[model samples]
Target: MSLLLDTDNSAKPPVTTFGPDFPFDYDRWISHPAGLGRLPDDQLGQEVAVIGAGLAGIVAGHELMKLGFKPVIYESSRMGGRLRSEPFSGADGVFAELGGMRFPVSSTGLYHYIGQVGIETKPFPNPLDEATPSTLIDLESEQFYVEGAGHGALPPLLREVSEAWSGALEGGADFTALQDAVRKRDIPALKAIWNKLVPLWDERTFYDFVASSPSFAQKSFRHREVFGQVGFGTGGWDSDFPNSMLEILRVVVTAQDEGQRMMVGGAEQLPRRLWHLAPTTLAHWPAGTSLASLHAGAPRPGVTRIARDEAGGGIAITDRWGDTRRYKAAIVTCHSWLLTTHIDCDESLFSQKLWMALDRTRYMQSAKTFVMVDKPFWTERDETTGRYKMSMTLTDRITRGTYLFDNGPDKPSVICLSYSWMSDAMKVLPLDAERRVRLMLGALQKVYPGVDIASHIIGEPITVSWESDPNFLGAFKGALPGHYRYNRQMFCHFMQDSLPPAERGLFLAGDGVSFTPGWAEGAVQTALNTVWGVLHQFGGKTLAENPGPGDVFDAIAPVDLPA
Candidate 1:
């Protein structure tokens, strides 16, 4: 159960999942220092243990190693925790991303991480440019409206409205002027400026603020659809800027070009590559062993165990074997509700109290369906409108959150369609695997008729009903009214614990801590920040200081950039 090191040091070529076609030479990129074996025992003993192996955990470990701290990572499951990407064998071995899929170009840190690992990403195809003659349907009215190629039809006033707002927000205009407008409570003018400022509002819960918006009551725009687009930002609820919906929006628009790229094999290829990237720390170290009984801290050095705490820290993290692991410090890359149980904690360690009051937080419910057909059905359109690539349809009538995924490149083509109930405040349905797949296929058929549902479904569908998965008790996290204060406090406390000086012997890193969410960027950013916090604790400089040019955040402000 434990791995103890016998030799002074051992170096080996990194194992990789990528075949020869991969762009970077993994062998050349990762090197084991030749003289590392000569270091004294005291030097080697200066160790840090990271408890999770998801994106955040891996990044944290990589960063620590770079700083000369030999990081020992402990995880109950396989590495790449929530960044779990699996290939569906039924689709002619063509991969469908079961977990975290897309990344935005705006995530400079994530992009850099991809590069560091020597993995390549291409832009995800935009669904707006295709001509498959797709239309948003309104079931109530029995009406359907088609969008023209390139840009769809927009209300005359609304067109100018959106343009003006986007210009101001992305151009970096100050929000102080907009704050003045909101303070005055001028509804029309406020609506004009609201779009520009939503990015900064991540401090506020979307459900509360949007529900209270005058626009929501007046039906000024396709509010729910717009909200969904905005919400599906960088990483989702785990993002650091939990209240800033617009920052999420910005990640998507920017990544429209970059998100189009997929792995040469599929998303699953990346995780498989990560697994082979480093030798299992468990394999080489004698003192390093799997923990069986979960404790605040246990087993001296090599002994570790999984134990269930009556109260959950975040949703209890179920190990790879489906056992629960309690924690003093946790890297929560999973869904919010999974860990949001009303568990009491030591006041001194988790004084924020929000951890105990998670029942009050609101989360949106969503369903996703993936289908592999003998041929691509969406041949009607091309890369731009999702007719051929990815597309979204919004009309006066259609149900919201319905869309098609692009699975054109692989041998057995596939398409992913999704639907969500943004305003529905209901308990997530806990369905067994058989029932979950049945509902998913049923929903997909309702959205796209004439498509052969049974013929294309080569195997059982992979379903993630946030309601059932213990690791992710619900979908993503959402803020509630006045909950912003609690959010900030919770994150600050967690970040502080991650600091090397904190002596908590625990660390925190994940989607919940990054500045953006609903995507991989947030997780990666938080991971990077976790490293920075850890390094600062060990008397090391920030990532900017240690990683050279690849640093995501500069010590100098953007304003300091030379003209």
Candidate 2:
């Protein structure tokens, strides 16, 4: 967002998930407009192996390559990672956003790529956007439509639910104080407030906070149920019930779920563009060389093993095809569990404290199913039924949330038959796309008795169970109660000087290791953390006036690990 941009647009926000923002300026890191520091002549040709061609890996490689280092990226699958955009069998310019669909403006780090890449973004058909002119909230045989959240007056029950959540925040955490600190970017105040509450909330679940908070306690348990069923912003909070209260609070205070937009074509376009974008100021290589150009338009094979190169060399990586190469530095952007489960990583590569953090990180489950229709028939209003043909729906039925994507009135449109998480997702995990669509359509039939949804489906359905993907294992990290120390260890792993020589050149990054998982902001920011770290390892330095993150990390760093 422009909130962080300064008069000359050479600065960045002063808030970091790992702590208060770095004392140094971000503009110092980027000599070029894209944000990068120059590597010394001696460090120019150093090879930096980047594993996983996801956002974190891609961003790290893209930036490092700009700084004159050779960043060869490897991937087990496609380049976009969780930003998978699948199209119908015969349709063009139409797709099902299988993962990481909506993005909020608060995600300034990600917006940097989006803006530079020049991709068009439109309002996602969230609860309240131009895409969703109407929204239906259906439950217990009762149905109601609102213009959009906060657009018009809310129903009595929803009003009570909203007020109760507000009250709960006020009573439990002093919501206004924290929110003010967050918005004002008051690092000291935020640390002072958040540190005290972290220990208390680290041991508490979201449900525990809701149930025990004075606001919800005064009202019956029904208030909590109502809040879970239809929470403010996206939808239900129930899926996050098992996560630590700190997790939910971070999301809430940051408002990463609010006022978001979706890329017009597909969210993947940004990363894809970055891969092919030949920056004007690239060093060492030819002026026109891009990551795609350097890799010959294809990523290297997936990494299978990582070891400390024994002959006083840097790190050694072995890919799936049995090719082993040594690089000065390696950034593992793959999921954390992959380090232990799939990769043959040496135990000494990480401390037991770091290993515990990596191994115990919890991930959430998510599923989404989509189908293309002949047209946006939902825009039609039935004279007899007294309701628009269909609306962006939220329900308590088998299909929890259904979204409508209108390409145009006459063009093929997409409907997310069901976008469920946690238990709701697991319910349909066993079913194929067709069967899931059938079940979702059947469920929708119950909600809108006379509506004929199946007849409008013009093409095949697309579905995803992120948990089923071996590479991801689960959607994203959803830290459980008491996992704060693990998170702290993981988030701070970029400071390799604190580690022994055996683990020094290996860096950990990705949304998985970030403090705010499931958000691209975390991925982008953490990847930048590694870029700064790797640069420093190779004797790179930022301009003295605009120091980089690592230049003063110790002073500004937060998350003091527990003894």
Candidate 3:
């Protein structure tokens, strides 16, 4: 057994049962103190073209270099991709996390790099958390405040909604069996149970499942409405009500969204650190060589086109400035939609089925706008009223989720005035930062009546409409009903050798290509899968003692229908 799985000998993962799969003990494999296997000496000088400088690209590049391959990366934007950290203009230590703020403890794959970079973390100040201080749930023209640690009981309707969901899952989904199998890391047991659920839930929407469940139907539709308002674990599920029920099951069963923490400085530190760190020795370069030094301190230009380098038995990629380069293999870590829209990728590179999967992919829309304040005003107690000045809020208004970040009472604080999704996000897409702030403020103002929110402002606000960002068409892929086949096709793309020659050298990877989308863990996991694919293409093999997830993929790959 791997030392990582031996601590307890109970088969229970370090985190909970809800994160994506960690079949290979990746954290231990990546830092094999004794070191991982090396590639053939003759392949040491060969270059691998890496597209995108995000977490996926950087991680893939770093690991490939450890095996002696030269990785030249290309990016249209700054490093970190959607894990963006916008530091306040004049204030140090304060930042607006425009993307991926909270990370679940189950994200062991992601944590391997985080720990390697020495990033500090604290439990996210989520609603009901001890660190939250207080929370205000405003909906249906009624507002209530819960004190620090969320000690008080919630409204009766909320409790009933929770009970109904628990009963429904327990009775209809064999919830206990699923959780136990996941906790045990018993892949066969998990498949034996989940395989039956795929066909049952694949064709059903989340709303359909909820409405048809005897537990939910036994209660009034009002309870259903309440359930939508205060969803299980996470906040409202109104935006996800139309998505596939299997997606919801995957999230809950894996417990992927709970017990989350935020990186102390910012999440971007992981990739930035990997960009410069040097190993004791490198395959092609001298000791102390790093990715930054390998690329002369910058990434190559954004990729504009990709095609088969047929005569060269490799793949050719063209940059935005029309600089064409060919390589023995390449890994594409960009959003899948970019293949058909922004880039002129050759049609023959992927089969018809893969193209259908890519074209049909549905990316969710998301919007977030942040403002800096002079202090953590929300934590301040109002003397006469015995109420907080403001509270971390979740509501039904335009702003569905509002978050607060405190550097310290003495320093500038960040207020994520609005963090909404789908239709709610689209409602604020057309507004500029100030206008979005005004809209969110107007909505929040009505809820708080007397709180002078604008008075504490320290600087201009930061906002993002992922749908409006050209580089990313949407926040992340949200698989819809009957989309399981498409997801399987994308997720299993690393098995490209089964496809025609045109599809062999160019591989796909990213959150969009993962079974669990919208999570950085998925991005890292899929990037590692592609690393294995590229390695095999170069005739390299994973270390026998530290095999990758792909090495055992046949037994653990997602359940799919016959061809």
Cα lDDT of all candidates, in order?
0.40, 0.81, 0.81
Candidate 2: pairs in clash: 29-36, 30-36
**Greater-TM-score candidate between 1 and 2:** 2
User: Cα deviation of 437 in candidate 3 (Å)?
Assistant: 0.9
* Residues 183-274, model 2: lDDT tens digits: 56676787777777888788899999999887688787767887787677787789999999988888766667676789989988877899
Between candidates 1 and 2, name the one with more favorable lDDT: 2
Please, what are the lDDT tens digits per residue for candidate 3 over residues 1-563?
11011124245544443322334455556676644455777788688999999899999998888778889899988898899998878888788888888887777778878887788889898876666777788888688677665323556766577678877777767876777777666767778888888888888999998899998999999889877876745577878899988888777776675667999989888789889989665566788888898899999999999988978978898999999999988999988888999999999888999999999999999999999999888777787778888888888888888888888767789999999999889988888999999999999998888899999998778999898888998999898999989988888888766777767888787888887888888888788878888877777777787776667777676777765
* Residue 361 in candidate 3, Cα distance off native in Å: 0.8
After the best TM-score superposition of candidate 3, give how far the Cα of residue 545 lies from its true spot, in angstroms: 1.7
Model 1 score (lDDT): 0.40
TM-score of each: 0.61, 0.94, 0.94
In candidate 2, where is summed lDDT lowest over 10 consecutive residues? Answer: 1-10
